[model samples]
Target chain A: MSTKTDKIDRLAELTAQQESSSGASLWREALKRLRASKMALVGAWIIAVFLLLAIIGPWVAPYAPGQQWRGEVFVNRAEFVGARAENWFGLDHLGRDIFSRMLVGARQTLLLGVVSTLIGLSVGALIGSFSGACATLGGRVGQRIDSVVMRCIDIMLALPSLLLAVSVAAVLGQSMTTVMIAIGVVQIPVFARLLRGAMLVQGGSDYVLAAHSLGIRKRRIVLTQIMPNSLSPVIVQATLSLATAIIEAAALSFLGLGNPDSAKNPEWGVMLTQAQNYADSAPMMAVYPALAIIITALGFTLLGEAMREALDPKLRG
Target chain B: MSLLELDDVKVHFPVKKGLIFDRTVGHVYAVDGVSLSVEEGQTYGLVGESGCGKTTLGRSVLRLVDITDGSVNFDGTDLAKLPAEEMRTFRRRLQMVFQDPLGSLNPRQNIESILSEGMAAHGIGGTREERREKIRDILAKVGLPANALARYPHEFSGGQRQRIGIARALVLEPDVIICDEPVSALDVSIQAQVINLLEELQESLGLTYLVIAHDLAVVRHISDVIGVMYLGSLVEEAPSDALYAEPRHPYTKALMSAVPVPDPEVEDRRERILLTGDLPSPANPPAGCRFHTRCPWAQDTLCATERPALKDVGGGHKVACHFAAEIAAGTVERTAASVVPATREEMADRVVETPAE
Candidate 1:
């Protein structure tokens, strides 16, 4: 027992010294844990490479994403001297370079996923805070409000998320913004429930009760005290949701509910739609875009899983 | 004038049952009709067994828990009558130190933020530099180093965490602090250190404290005045030394007997009056004397039918008992039925048998 306490004391002293000198915060501690996970580091590297490729792909591609090539029999190779070398990943039935299309497709896929997930996260967090704050009141009025908000979320959650997104997309018409809105609206309930549950537990903590006794305003307590502490789980959930958002966006595009400029556009789902006819003959056309979607989703999933494990005390050690 | 006064304060929690809509089935009388006053610069120790509602009474004084009925007057202001906005400002004069040292401080926040939270809320200490200096000063007074400010609550031991808890309250410069079992969760040796620190701070700052604890010895050592509570009512109130020397109430005598005497010879020779049966549920306490069901000197007729009001005996010592003098003088004989052990389950069954609320 003495040795155990002694070790604890030593550990505490070391941390205290480190904290005083560097002013270490919770974020810093989380970063330290993130750095320790090799999978998280690899995911971060993949995301960086993907983002760089998406931004500069148009400038660097040998052929324009929309430029198509005719075969040697149809057109002389000498007339289009660089066509054979440039269309390395070959051409679709539309004759667009599959390699260039996949490169440009990354831009649309990532942009839609991030924007929609952020929209979902913000709306869900707002609703969650409202319901969570009401529940903390712990009176008749609070209980009534809490039950109403939670039941509404339950109704949304009852429908399959993809089906809801599909119907929403169908109504809005074929546009990238519409696709984002559809996927974003479908994910609101997941974030709402996670945040609300986290806040409920945090609201009941002794420190929150102590804050009440100190005469801190309810708003300040909910914002400064409860929100920050309750945010880790919601953050982890958001990362995981981003991966799902990307896949959902791709699915919508594949169903012809995506970008209206299907012929000229290089969105992954549009490429897959265009590549279906030649899927058996030149399987690489389908393989390239499908690989791009799979790898991007895998990156986010790995990072999200690592973050969840990092935040979990039982899993950390 | 007394620093704090509770005039028959009561806090009852509604017991709810139902699936679709919750219906109030009954009430748990956590604190029922408790009245006491604490003078300025004095330590008033509240003692009771677990679930006796002493903690609720302390919280009521600070208006942390709303009073269902009655008034809590602090420094000439009726807290119950004050509006929410006014009460919030008035809260600056009062503060609390919770029982669990670790749980009471925000784990995510560093020591500086935790200690400065009250000051930030009340808008005390004008500038950042001023607030930082004030926090440093308070940390020193609480025996923590200035560097401790950057550390989180989890880094500290139970004793250090308590000192930080005290520092948080003291930084606000409040007139009264309600310490709810502040040392109960600490190690035996650390309990004395924390208790002594509280006493020294009280003397230096002239801070009035409502110390709630179940340990009689700790209370006897620190409190100037002591109030003993049972099933949500004050059964005895007196100066600590006088109450310890000559306990008047039958319940007080029984409580005092339970405290083991240090010397083995004296401890063996002392008469231990063991009270039979469990404490009656506050929701449905026995009519008349709440203690009659377990009191050795209880009379058959009046003790069971009429509740005894807290009346003064002598020297400002008040006790709520029909035969306080006879019981204290050892002239009253124990009723045979009162000596039989009644488990808490049996007592709960009796409460269920009682038809009325």
Candidate 2:
């Protein structure tokens, strides 16, 4: 027979190892894994810098964004004022300071991105949770309710998202609020479908049945157990949607369905639109705003992808 | 009266068609007409093959699934007829232990919260300290370390996770615990420990159990009374010793024949009853006696046309079969026609049709 000390030592080591990890939850463990990923750290840093710029861009801008003091010097047909010391980033076709417009535009872009995402996330989560709860716990009548809600969602999903966004913006009339609503409305079906699917899976698990048998109130089960467990995918979708929302908002502005008062508070998309007239003379004006938009969208996309990996059940062990 | 009496329980799920506007095409009678009772502090084991509705029956006890037509009389009141709100309160005395240990406990919750949740819902303890004391007491009874209360379900081994599930049930001081395939998910070595823990808990706490499992040996060991399910109904039920000593039903005999005797001599001497054909779909179950299609001693007319009642054949042994007496007496021989391949028409009819509801 083998000696027992070595086995005992191994067992003790295992025990100590287990003892060291007290109350480490799925979320906490995911957070730890997220911290370890360099991708997540880089993405987080980009978002942090972007948020800082959004908050402080207006105050730091050298000139008033709406002022077109160098109008006479910036004749689009004959002469172009390239980036110079006096007017860094040069004057636009309308002779507004290009650098100052971009800086102030940062705050408006951030507002559109966050507000649209929030609109989509909240409305979608509410609709999804309602539909899921009905389907899972509502018995026969609940099934009917789910079918109705899902059919409506299906109709929304059937339309091409960009076309749908365009229609919503066209109907709402041109403004920042219009673009936000349009993007938010387009994201509704996606968020709703994801949350419902996740909740359906969670609702069928043994814990849900266990909770039911425990005589926990059905409302409490739906709210506390089912809702919390089903939120991860929705959350991942929200982050990814943020990037999409920003891009879509810019597209709306470029299409002239965004803020009407472009000269006063110039958005990047509006700048790109205004720059189209001076394509031969001032190509740099379009290039600057395009780069800004692409980089910001990239930041959110990276963060979203990193979060998806961290939260993945396959990677948990 | 028995502590829990399930009288003529049935659960039928409707088959629906159409995307938005649904139509009830037919019904899948999942748990069709099953009735059994359990005594206080007695372990009533239910053994069945897969897809035999044993799990559904267990769920029906707590009304987790809708009871089509039945009277689930628990401690004098019919739970089937109780208001949903009242039933929620009444669930304090009844609990369920699930097959999957990890799946049963919330992955995000600590053992303390998992155990205390039921107690909090039932209003068992007045204060947090009182609940924690009770929870700790139960954790010990289930053979878990005190430190385990702070850990999540994923941290524990299969057996330990099972204990946490049991602890969650026990915290509410439930009188009856329906263990649905409790030990099946565990490892062989771990299965015995969990089984022993269940027995120990029963003896110490005077807890009654309605255990649903497929393992014959596990059932015979712990169950005072054992019921065997085929399709959605009980085919045989008797005292554990009596059922093992002499299995009366043809289906029971076939099930028992599968269990190999440890001694080589005895094992070789025993006759093996190998059943032919797969289990018919519950949606279109055989017309009458559910087991008639594959029963070794199946006759043409009576076995196919008429459903058999669970009749007592002396010594508290109940069986649902027309030829139980003749077969037990060694008079009726095995029919070769029972094993015959299905005819072309029969094969065509096997595809279940959606009947108008």
Q: Which of the numbered candidates is closest to the native, going by highest lDDT? A: 2
lDDT of 2 by residue, A176-260 (tens): 8999999999998899989999999999998998888888888989987898789888888888888888888877877778889
lDDT tens digits by residue: candidate 1, A1-317 = 99999999999999977756555566666778999999899888888888998898777777777776655322222222223565777777656777887777778878888999998899999988889988985555986998899999999999998889988988988798999999999888988988899999988888888888888888888888899888888888888777788878777877778888765557877787666655555567777777887787788888988887777645534
Q: TM-score of each candidate?
A: 0.86, 0.91
Instruction: Say what the RMSD of model 2 is.
Output: 7.2
Q: Candidate 2's residue-wise lDDT over B1-357, tens digit each?
A: 899999999988888888657798988888888888999999999998999899999998898988989889999999999999999998888999999998998887788888888877888898989988888888888888887878888889999999988888888888999999999999999999999999999999999999999999999999999999999999999999999999998888888988988987666555677788998898889988999989989988699999999999998999999999998888888885533334434455665443432
Candidate 1 displacement at residue A67 in angstroms: 3.6
Compared with the true structure, what per-residue lDDT tens digits does model 1 show for residues B1-357? 787988999999888899878899998899988889999999999999888899988888777778899999899999988887788888888988999998888868888888787899899999888999999999899898888887888778999999999998998899999999999999999999999999999989999999999999999999999999999999999999999999998888889988988987676556777888899998888899888888878888789999888898989899999988887777888774434345445667899989865
Candidate 2 Cα errors over 4 Å, as ranges: A1-21, A67-78, A84-88, B337-357
Q: Which one is best on TM-score?
A: 2
lDDT of each prediction vs. the true structure?
0.84, 0.87
